[model samples]
Target chain A: MESDKDNASLLGGKLSVINVGLDKFATELADHDVPVVHLDWKPPAGGDPKLAALLSKMGT
Target chain B: MDIIEKANEEAIRRMLGAEPVLINVVPAREIVPNLQDKMILHAGPPIEWDRMCGPMQGAIAGITVFEGWANDLNQAFTMAASGDIAFDANHHHDAVGPMTGMTTVSQPMLVVENKTTGNRAYCAINEGLGKVMRFGGNDAEVLNRLAWIRDVLGPAMGKALRDMGGIELKPLIARGLSMGDEMHQRNVACSGLVLRAIAAAMAKTSDDGTELSEALAFISANDQFHLNIAMAMGKAIMDPVRDIDGSSIVTAMSRNGTDFGIRVSGTGDEWFTAPVEMPEGLYFAGYTEADANPDMGDSTIVETIGLGGFAMGASPAVAGFVGAGAASEAANYTHRMSEICATENPEWTIPSMDYLGVPTGIDVRLVVDSGIAPTINTGIAHREPGIGQVGAGVVRAPMACFEQAVRRLAEKLGIS
Candidate 1:
């Protein structure tokens, strides 16, 4: 998961209303260190470490 | 017009500006658990007789034999054919049933009372997995489990309720809304709350710790037991607003063994109904589309009133049964529901709607005007009877029902 600061920075580039890749989003978030609250139901095959951080943090 | 006619007429008047609502349910029983059974307890609208697949019919026969209403499978069929037994939706009686939602007076039903209007409804417990009536498989195991629930669990809970005054589920629901439970698919928080409250009261004067522990464990294990309460709470909350004069707020969403039906508050309680179909989504291992039952039970009332699928975003985990698209569809479902509603819930709000207030109240006019049918987040069962649950999916109320409702409301309200 990315830090809140990095997440804020990456939100614009990573998030897309239609068809945004979660991997790219998670990676960008990780780069910036933004904390993701949770993961979408299906992951981007093989799962992402950023997603793990988000789930543990979110307690889902 | 006489009272009955007046009641029916009143039902019509409420259909004008129906708003949707979110209702949460909690058990008044001291201990809650997942009552394990041979069949997965399916909930919601019933399937049509002609439409029933093999499993559904089998479950019906199984229920009869389980209840001792019939001596055997052949006798059960004979009784059904003779019409000696009444086949009514749990919704009609203000009750909810799990998948395949079958119930009889003999079944120990949980009567949930909405204190606001003194309106009460009943629902049978969810028979957890395997050969349960809702899944449409009937066998000795199913019958024995039914007997156990009625003979033991029901009575024990009755005593506990008597000991610790009736419970108020309203507060728990309000709190659960924030936690992650939509009070439908994700009731983990709500379940815990129910158990905690009841166990505290039961501990005061209970038998051994083993009995108490076992009961508590049961509720913790089953995620769907609270569905009955949610259905009742929805019934209770909506009952107060039912048959309001010239109001289009929908008050009740229910299904008989054959049709999916709803009552608009301003439409004067006249039921607009349509045939039910299976919802498409994920299901248990080994269960395929062929293993499911059609929509069953009265629990749809919960979703109809706004808390079930519409609030799915709250419980992201719900993606399992309803499938992945959980978050966005949660909002989408809420948005679709808003098309039919007259107002937002002043109280309940689903966080996934970005914390937007739930689409409260189903309005007939809005439904007809927009042509966007309300989307229900539901579990899909096999089209044939007796096969049990094959998967889960989303479905919609037939558009014609709302169209007719709007037209009728227009006539009653003298709208051009």
Candidate 2:
């Protein structure tokens, strides 16, 4: 019962979030008065798996 | 740092340390090496006459007539089709030019020397605005203006530069950045600066008072007068950065009407190219997207060393002109570019970004990792030849070019 109350208190407190990949999630969270940071991330090597593997080999 | 990182650092170091100076203005035949008779040097990578887009074809015909190879445009077109004219990329001859970028033996060329490395590069003089050959307008009037530039302006400026002992471009470009000139689509500030640097010398050197006034008026009236000089400066600075082993940093980026091309430091002279993209932005009155041609020019050299769109934060006026949204959004472009570039240019900093340096030395690996291509600020020409500039705007270098470059670079370094 005490643990459940603690969980509820944690959920009720101010929330901050880090959004990766798509920025829409960050925008939505910020609209709800939440603090959020968005990272401009993309799949490496232009989403080409072979190129990504090559990039890894090159240690980029 | 690893081998690639160390090589790239060296490349950027050489690029940043370069000091390009405007040395002289002379005819293409006089200064540019291996420029043969009946040969025409054009922008972008090597392209055949049949593959050339409208503006290039139009410019070629105009230049043929200007060189007296043909009597009329129709004859010039037939000759161009007949294979009498030898065509080569300006880059092959240690030179560069703007849109259509046509340079025959007769036309005057601006020479810029990298003072530190003792290397030099060349570009043709910019014919001020509308109905000019650079935009592929060929008529009696265009030919007349070419003649005047060849006879009066070129000699006058050449004499002036020689008398004044050459203008240092680094400080001038720094001042231009502080002002609103991006040295690509917007060069108003640098144009005035060039005039200020050379006007007195031109006055003292010219024998004819009428010729001096006409040349001065032309320089003052043309807002992009310094663009060709800036291009030559870029070429001079970047040439020494080429051929550094293991460096994946892009040394050059250019576009013909049909294709865009880039050269990496590790890859040397080999060009990785893709189909060129059309620019999307605000158009002139009565012109729309329907009339715009694919982006074309050798001017992207500015971006290779970090200016133009990479320095967009410096010119909010260019932002609105190119339809890049509001003034506040300009710095965002620069910020985004920083993710793909190897480093920031300490000397060419943008004031609006708290004096943050312009992003410099494009790294192909970073571009593939981030999926952000270099943004280019450019003027849009008409789809059909002879119509001249229809608008100005921004476009991104194709991702495929960068991908191909990275793949080639990896193969070259034995990573594959």
Candidate 3:
């Protein structure tokens, strides 16, 4: 639970971001001297279209 | 504040204050001032005839036939190849359109006016899915649909709009942002809202209620019916911000099938263009990535105003179309846009952000420094002429465009 003071700090403090989808964005943010964390994300179920379809079918 | 900051603030102020009202629909030549008989307006920055991509060339050919300038496709092609017909960018004429995005003199265009700034913008009526001219369908069926939209649909819509006094689009767009429409990839809710606003007026304007109902039904079925109006509204909103001396805010982002282009407020009318990137997303059945044309359209205006891809957090359903595949990823995509924008537009709130404003006023300096280009949701036309839309997806404005604009802005500001 973040307190009011913590929330305020978060709003105006050192900027950091968790960038997914494209690594280029993360690289660019770093070039600008902005603090950022890049998380390489992929579709679930190891990106197998059929298995992911089944997982969606099971509502997971 | 510095010059850039002051200019950016002024730019954003004009954008925030815009009140787009759909006043009427009229032929492109009648409403669009100085629209000459031989001149054709297309999406994105200007390109010569030989450089235009297949879909754009195909659309020009179709428009020529529609205008009776040529009797057939071959003759139209010859006319175009010979430079008998002139081509200019839609932005140059205060107009915009979706893919292939060629607007001829006689085509009916929606006229949207910003009551706040007294600026007006025009956009062609959306021809609605499959076998449409905008997507490069130039056959008789496509031409016939254009005629119907020109003759029957345009008059009916114009009459209905006139009956209502005018339909205010800004508030409706505000409602739509909250109701799962970013007004580009998915306009289902806004389409419904427009119908609800004008359905009564539509009925009132026509004598034969059945014919009117059929037209209304056609509108009801096309979820993207409100796209042209929204685009025109964006144009109306953004036109007031152009040439604002030192503003680094992007005024336009559009693409021809071959190239993508951007214009910064401070840079006046100069365009920063780069090679277009093909969109990556699910294709319609029987279509694949190889068949996809490079992204095209003036629909990117939605993104320029902080809707389309920027408001995706509020439109979780768009995840599938843009390949996010999950609501959280869509939300993150919207959050990412804020990193490059100058400010958020409080008027257009994204519900998922706890009603935080949608990110507005894309700053070229921030974009260059951050290296994050604006994301756009778009319809993919088939690369070949006349096949129509193959799929829909997301693509980024090329980083080179932002870099180029930033360099120009820096030079203009006398900064190293």
Candidate 4:
């Protein structure tokens, strides 16, 4: 779960997504001079075990 | 001068030589190169519509009624099939028309001419949205509006145009290009400029206060009323370069809600065609996707030669209708379109283009070589009978049609 501060930071104003890996996953339109509302994907509960395991393997 | 000579002369001067001309708008029957398979001499016309959208059929029905050729829809279709009425394209005769581009013999149209080069261009008058013929809603009220345009608006505009000598559309398009307008969807600044220019004429030459008031009111009311002028400007700009020997530049693009078609310079006046699809976007309050028709209209000529959907970043409102993307998609569309064009509009420069000219002259060879056909921003009509404008969206011109046209033209030029 996102804290109110983090949610506000993402929602209330612009958040320039950092790093190429995340940028590739997210919509590439954020960098333009024009503004388009951004959509994000969040895992459920503690996190999806499958996704967590996959990420851990990638990190290794 | 003969219409063909006039058209060819005008087309070359403005398009190839890069000059401006006063475009002359006329009915398709009056100017077509040939009349084969035509229904009524319509603007950018002669669309045979078994494949047409439901709304287009409605407009054709209204046109039949307007012309006193038939009392009802069945009768109109029967008469059309029996070949009693002539159908023809406006561009086929050296003119252009708007959506549902029906031009009857009686309806007067705008005639923009370039005196220096003897080139001319044309377009029919605007039909205000709800229940209007252009949006493909046909009724008694629609016929009445057409009548009013014929009896009052057309003559009044012609008189005003004559009184003002000639309105230089280039300046307005140039200015609009800078102010977030690609001379297509968002024409606020240019439209306002046209109204103001016409208003000045209305102020000077009219003793009939109400007539002048009505004209001014009408012009001020519709944001897109200047689309006619832009069409005229586009014609003036592109008509000159047609039939330039081996040149591959495109001079025209128009759709009949059933099919989208284009004409390239190398092929003279031949139209290459493909099936049209509905634009992919949002709708006005009460409309839906089914309410929309496949993309239709002469407005595509704005982009065919560049400066409408090709320059979308210049018009944000268009993005709302055609799906959303940021400035780059819009800019990239312009840049991509540049790959297919031969030149840029010296006068109509897009601000987002980093002050570069609006891409001019669509080239079929480049389109085939690069694999990116132009995109259009358009209105969709209901697919079924009686429902009008459901939504608006964006769509691409099919690449197959361009490839076919290029193959044929290449064969003709021996470049294949």
Candidate 5:
């Protein structure tokens, strides 16, 4: 339990980034050795109901 | 690692230590060394007359008329075609200019010097907005404005600047950055600050009250009057970093309408070039993207020293000028650019970024590895000569240029 707490403190929890603009900001963070998850942002329907339904069915 | 580390440190140190002062305004022939009869200075990497773009050709024709070498455009063209004129890149003479970027001997230029290093750079006074020779407007009105700047405005400014001892720009740039100016696309704050700095001296130097007030009023109303001074300042700051062996930091970036080019610190005088790209943004009435010339100018020197697009986050007001209106969008451009930079400039900080400094010292390797190019906010000239500016927008340096710089640096350092 102490080790788990120490590990959590050491890592400082996951720091995620949603880069909706240029991909480089995330890349810079990554280059600095920070773990960053890039969120692929798109409008809810992808402007197409049929395509969004297909994506949802594929469990995306 | 040692060589690159040392060079990068030296580059950054000189860039940060730079204190550009607007010391004088003088005829280009008087200050620009080696400027002789029939010689013209143009922007970007060097090129031949045959390959010169339309606006450049127009500026040349207009300058010829202004110089009394030719009576009109037709005569100028004849002389140009017959090889009676000589042209050289402005970079060769330690100068930078906006669109069409013509600096002939008789033209007056604002002289900026880095007081710390004794290095200097020159740029023509900004001929604010429409129907100007810089954008290839060759009408009598254009020539008239140029003459007024040369005969009246330039002399008054020279006297005022000399009387005031000189105006330092770095502090104004820092203050302007804090107050809605990125010092390129938006210089309204800096212009006002510069006016306040020199107004008393300007008033004192003028022969009459009317002349003084007119000159002051012209600068007051023209928001872009500070741009050429800023370009000169950028050139002054970046010059000491040039030719630093093994450093990958970009020192100069410029474009002719035909080509885009950059000079890396380690690469010395060699230029890495790619075809120019058209800018994407808001156009003036009756003009569209089709009207824009490929991005052309030495104004990118602003971005080279970490202002303009690199400092976009600090000036959300300019976002609308480049299609993005949101403050978040502005911050995103700056944040994205940080990835390709060696370090954040310690001096120039952005208010929106929680006062984090703007990114400085563009690293070629990071640019290539991330496939991200440096962004520039610029005025788009009309594709044809003599049409002047059609709009303002954002553009990116070509990736190929960065890739080439990286390849050359690798070869120079004997690395794979």
Candidate 6:
């Protein structure tokens, strides 16, 4: 019962967020007065699985 | 650190330590080794006549006529197809050129020597804007200007350069960077600087007042006059960085109209290639994307040494001209470029980035790992021959070339 009350308190507190990959989520959060940071990210090796595997093999 | 990382550190060190100086201007045959009669050196990797793009073909024909090998463009085209004339890349001869990048035996070449390594490189004089041979203009007027450069301007500049004991390029380029020149699409500041450096020397060396006055006026009027000089400087600086055993740093990146190619330090002269991409930017009035040719030139050598687009933060004035978004966004381009490079150039720094060095020594492994290709600032030429420039813009070097380079490098090192 105490843990459940703690969870409710945590959920009600001021929110800050870190968004990665697509930035739409961060933009939406910012619109609602939430502090947010967006990280510009892309899949390694242009998202090519074979190239990514090769890169890993090369120990890059 | 690993062997690859150690080798890369050495390569970048040699590149930064290079001090390229403009020594003299002379005929191509006189300076470039093994440049034979009837041979034409062009930009990019080796390409056959049939695969040559319209602008390249046009430039070849123009050069043939300019050299008096053929009477007209039609005859020149037939001769080019007939195999009587030989063609090669400028890179094979330790030289570089812009646009179609035609370098024949008779054209005057600017000779730049790297004081650090005792290696040298060459390039042709930049023809003033409008219909010119570099962009495939082969008309009688173009031929007349070529004749003037070969007979008059070349000799005058050569004398002036020799008289002044050659100008050291490092400080000049550094000053230009601070004054809004990127040594690529925008060279106004550098051009004025070159004129200031040589004006008195040119006067002292010239016998004819009219010729000296015309030469001064010409240099002052053309904003991009310093680009060819900068190309030779880049080639001179980067040549000594080649052939390191385990280095994955890129030594060269260039494009023919059909293909874009890159050379890695570990791979020697072997080129990793992919289809070239078209540039996206603002077009001249009455022109659009359909009118533009795919990217082509050896001018990317400047970027290879971290001056052109990689230093975009230094010249916000070029941001709008190249269609690289708002001026305020220019520093972002540099910041992104930093993600893939081996190090930053301490000698050349951008003020807008709080005196941060320009990104230097492109690493093939980092490019593949991060999936960010090098951005190039370039002028758009007309797809059809002889139409000259249609626009200017920024383009991405294709990612496929970097992927291939990384694979080949890994294979060479016996990692896969």
lDDT of 3 by residue, B1-416 (tens): 26677888899889998889998989888888778998888898999999998888898998899999999999999999998999999999999989888888888889999999898999998888877888888999999878888887788889999888889997898899889998998999999999999889988899877778778888989999999999999999999999999888999999998899999999999999999998887788898999988999899999999999988888999888767578778888788899878889888898777997889999876665555678898898888887898888999999878767866766686655
Comparing 2 with 6 on lDDT, the higher-scoring candidate is 2
Q: Which model is ahead, 1 or 6, in terms of lDDT?
A: 6
The list of candidate 6 runs beyond 4 A from truth reads A1-17, A23-37, A57-59
Runs in model 3 lying further than 4 Å from the true structure: A1-60
Best by DockQ: 6
**DockQ (CA atoms), all models:** 0.02, 0.53, 0.02, 0.02, 0.03, 0.55
Candidate with better TM-score, 1 vs 6: 6
Can you give the lDDT of residue B60 in candidate 5?
A: 89
Q: Write the per-residue lDDT of candidate 2 for residues B85-166, one digit (tens) a residue.
A: 9999998888999989988898889999999999999998889887788888888888999999999999999999999999
Each candidate's chain B TM-score?
0.82, 0.99, 0.98, 0.88, 0.98, 0.99
Model 4 local distance difference test score: 0.66
Q: Write the per-residue lDDT of candidate 5 for residues B332-385, one digit (tens) a residue.
A: 999988988888987799977999898999987667665668999998888788
Report i-RMS for every model.
20.8, 1.9, 20.0, 24.3, 16.8, 2.0
Candidate 4: list runs displaced more than 4 Å: A1-60, B1-39, B43-46, B72-74, B327-329
lDDT pick, better of 1 and 4? 4
The DockQ assigned to candidate 3 is 0.02
Pairs with steric clashes in candidate 6: none
Please say which candidate is ahead in TM-score: 4 or 5: 5
lDDT of 6 by residue, A1-60 (tens): 579888888789988898998899999999999999999888999888888887877657
lDDT of 6 at B321: 93
Q: After superposition, how far is residue B70 of candidate 5 from its true place, in Å?
A: 0.5
Write candidate 6's Cα lDDT for B236-334 as tens digits: 988898899989989998887778889999999999999999999989888999988899899999999898899899999999999999989889888
lDDT of 5 at B354: 92
